[model samples]
Target: MLGQAKAFSSFSTNDIQQTKAFYEKLGLNVKVEDMMGEMLIMQLNGGGTVLIYPKPNHEPASFTVLNFPVQDVEKAVDELTAKGIKFEQYKDLNTDEKGISHQDDFAVAWFKDPAGNILSVVKDK
Candidate 1:
């Protein structure tokens, strides 16, 4: 019954301004809204919105909160790296020097936002 409802993902940040700058640097369309308080609305390229709200005691999520699927994981990683983004290396996950892990039919690279929230870029083979 709720399938038709337009749902969006939301996450908490300690500082909205810093979060906004980080997302903007990543080339996301972001806008500030004065709702319950100042919040950020990010327009996803694939079509959807993500709500970013501020909380005084915000704690970063250990798991990835968002994932961007790209045609070429290497290109995406290189571009983001050039933009000053650092990829996370996970020895247990068998990630490569570039921090990308090759699974059965896909490769994924992980990084963190300014607020320390994890995000990833994935490519399917």
Candidate 2:
């Protein structure tokens, strides 16, 4: 066997409802399941999951970050922008006029979830 490779993946957030809604607004169906103490879990379609636990009390092994594969870069960005998604840009990093970066086989766009989780979308190769 080639082994299991990588196993499960997840991230943490501050608020369940707001985080869920934020992903939903980005065209992802973020599902909220179970509530334990001040913590909750949310799943983002096809992109793994995020855990939403109360702030100032929960500590995670590491912060969650994600990179999504998309079919088209510009169209995806347009759709997200139409829904009020704002992208971050760094002048030090090469960004197009539309704030996306096209490098080699990958074209990328970026945004964040409600609780400050950084995320990116790249053209599926």
Candidate 3:
């Protein structure tokens, strides 16, 4: 039986500082513990959070990687790019363009967090 949807997911980042900074731009705070390159948490202001580790010990999750719901995917993309986050570009895939409004049916954009972890922002349906 499926229980509650994931509250958060985690990724292994090479640089924890940059990783933390990237999500911080998304209004997620860094929940850090002792500096052993152990586990790190990044929590969004009003929603879910993500755990980041230096090296992944368990199996890699072959899934959405990270999902974040936003009010405006375009605005989120613009704001994030302004902060130096690069949205993944695929010629075959339709991506967010222009200002803060992607009417791509569901208004969405995909990018990598500072940790090279795949993440997407979609308007709540």
Residue 22 lDDT in candidate 1: 95
lDDT of each residue in 41-90, candidate 3, tens digit only:
87665667767888644343444487778777777777878877777655
Off by over 4 Å in 1: none
Candidate 1 lDDT over 22-98, as tens digits, reads 99999999999999999999999878999999999999999999999899999999999999999999999999999
| TM-score of candidate 1 relative to the true fold | 0.96
Model 3 CA lDDT for position 41: 80
Question: lDDT at 65 for candidate 2?
Answer: 75
Backbone clashes per model, in order? Answer: 0, 0, 0
Top-down TM-score ranking: 1, 2, 3
Candidate 2 lDDT over 1-125, as tens digits, reads 53855344566766767776777676665555656655445455654555556565534333227787889988988888888888767576687776688777778877777777778878888
The lDDT values for all models are 0.95, 0.69, 0.67
Top TM-score prediction, candidate number: 1
Q: Candidate 1: lDDT of 18?
A: 96
Q: After superposition, how far is residue 38 of candidate 1 from its true place, in Å?
A: 0.5
Better of 1 and 3 by lDDT: 1
lDDT for model 3 comes to: 0.67
The TM-scores of all predictions, comma-separated, are 0.96, 0.75, 0.71
Worst 10 residues of 2 by lDDT: 55-64
